[model samples]
Target: MRSLKNAFAAALLLCSAMASAHRFHAGITDISFNARTGNTEIVHTYMAHDVEALLANLYGRQFDLTDPDDQDVLRKYVEGRFWIGGQDKARLPLRWVGMTADPEKVTVFQEIEQTPLWKAGAIHDNVLIDFIPDQVNTVNLNEGNAVRTLTFDRNQLEQPTR
Candidate 1:
């Protein structure tokens, strides 16, 4: 009976430790067409702690996302990892709109002017996947009343926009 109690206590302690150490590594991206602007806008949302950890791992130093230079670094990194291809398989000209960061979350804004959402053929989003193997990204395609979703992970980085 005493041994059973000891084992139960050990299991409880182990479970608590594992729960405290585990953190979710995920991001969400939204691609939507704006009729008023005649553009396709993209927005990415991620955990602020995860972004800071990624920046620190890449540059070996902490980054202030509010600073232009730091934001540019993150922009370049994101651009290289995520993009939309045209029907001809050519990459679209995705302009960086900007980004916002608070204590808990980081939001990035991008847009392609004069392009319809249906014009996108393929999407490649592997943001933070290289740095964190467990990272996963979900892209939501919002077109009119219909909505579609594509998930990206370490194994699947690119997928047809349709």
Candidate 2:
């Protein structure tokens, strides 16, 4: 009975340690054209805890994502890191549609008015990758009944939308 108890305790300890270790850093972004609105919409989702940690490390303070100032800071960081280019290689005018956050995740919304998804020449997404070496961002492009996935990692940051 004592041996079994010890073994159980050891297993619990190992599980706890594994949980404490950072397992993965990842983000998801979805880009789609809204036919009804004639707009190109973009949504990005990231782990809330990871974003909080990143903000704390960068600004040396805890950030309340609910605050406009804090959200703007994150927005600026994101804008600098991620963007979609037009066929002319110029960045599309992406308007920030704001963000929502919960304890588990943060979701950001953006849009390009009157632009079609097919007009997008390239995509650049490196959000959190600069801070987290192991970060990976997956972008899903949704068109009429079709979905294409592009992955951004340390090795690949930009990809053609075509």
Candidate 3:
């Protein structure tokens, strides 16, 4: 019984430490906005999740974005981790500071921090992305339709379509 308890405690400690140590994918892409900018640059990183549903989530009312609540809804949506920058190349640890958005651009900024996965010094990544927010997102290439998926294109984004 004592050995089992000790083993369990060790496993728990290792797991908790590992959980906090691992890095996660995070960044801002397709950033675009011009409406709200005061204390910080408001940026937007489009997410595949439906925007309409997000509006209803923020202020407890259906939002049309073009309405007055547009900015408020956007602010609420990106409060924690609503923006999707699509920069999944590396496991990035970032704390979103401010945001803004429009149909053409979505940007997010985080203080320079250690990118443990990068092997080098801090990544200092303030990703600014400019791309069409396609609703038809992509899964891994094994699922087929590699041409449609954004991952392949993002890596070699400038390459002409063959």
| RMSD to true structure for each model, in Å | 3.8, 2.3, 17.3
lDDT, ranked from best to worst: 2, 1, 3
Question: Best lDDT goes to which candidate?
Answer: 2
- Give the per-residue Cα lDDT of candidate 1 at 98: 99
Candidate 3 overall lDDT versus native: 0.35
- Candidate 2 vs 3: which has more lDDT: 2
- Candidate 3's TM-score reads 0.27
User: Which of the numbered candidates is closest to the native, going by highest TM-score?
Assistant: 2
For model 1, how does the per-residue alpha-carbon lDDT over 1-162 read when each residue is reduced to its tens digit?
999999999999999998776477999999999999999999999988889999998899999999999999999999999999999999999999999999989999999999999999999998999888999999999999999999999999999987
Q: What is each predicted model's overall lDDT from 0 to 1?
A: 0.95, 0.96, 0.35
Which window of 10 residues has the lowest lDDT sum in candidate 1?
17-26
Cα distance off (Å), candidate 3, residue 155: 19
lDDT of 3 by residue, 10-55 (tens): 9999999987762322233322121233111223344423444445
Provide the lDDT at 79 for model 1.
96
Clashing pairs in 1: none
Q: Residue 23 in candidate 1 has what lDDT?
A: 78
Q: Per-candidate TM vs. native?
A: 0.88, 0.91, 0.27
